[model samples]
Target: MFGLGAYRRWLRSDRVRLGRWGERRARAFLRRRGYRIIARNWRCPAGEVDLVAADPSGPIAFVEVKTRRDEHWAPGQQAVHERKQQHLARVAQWFARRYGLKDRSLRFDVIVVVVPETGRVEVRHYPSAFRPPC
Candidate 1:
């Protein structure tokens, strides 16, 4: 039946599916760059870190992946504004404390992906993308 409930559910699921797909692509890109995958979709009450990876030598990265279809009005990286960065920083702090990684350096990264219905998927990686007040 064409009801609001079904529509809402569909919207939620669609978003989830898209997020997962983007995360998957982001993970691959990080791996190719020699980042060891530490966690995916690490979440806390404050927010979620799409990907947590360890750099080659030291320090950890908290990645945010934004994927959009072709012709997005704005670049994906811009979505992680000051407020969003703060939330993710809080989440990263919680994750570090919880995982005994407080002693290590941490950085915020962003991966912007453009997945067209047909053709190559464009990915842009911005390491040290933002400064978080952690």
Candidate 2:
């Protein structure tokens, strides 16, 4: 039997490995879709956006990525609660203002990452997932 400390360490390591794997899957999916990745793991006082990308149309997108091993509890997109949405909007606004992108078009997106036990990853991208604050 594993001691408490050993179990905790195992859990932490597992989480870290899962996170990195999810991020890699997200990047690969985006690249295959022809979207140019501008940033990853962008953080601010408000919140963090997992990925930011731009298309040929000049619209900048802020993406929220949720990864899960199973869809038993809820779908990955459903994980973005109301509070999380608000934080994402705030952070996106800050990003726009800081970069003087006010006049440019912007959008919010969500990417759901589902990793099966076989290690295959499925990513679903939802464009314009939410509206920015007025």
lDDT of each: 0.89, 0.83
lDDT of 1 by residue, 16-104 (tens): 88878988999999899899999998888988889999988787999999988765588898999999999999999899899999789
Clash counts for all predictions: 0, 0
Q: List the residue pairs that clash in candidate 1.
A: none
Predictions: Cα RMSD each: 1.8, 2.0
Give lDDT tens digits, candidate 2, residues 64-119: 88878888899988887777888888988878887788988888888888887887
Q: lDDT winner among the candidates? A: 1
C-alpha positional error of residue 92 in candidate 2 after TM-score superposition, expressed in Å: 0.5
TM-score, model 1 to reference: 0.88
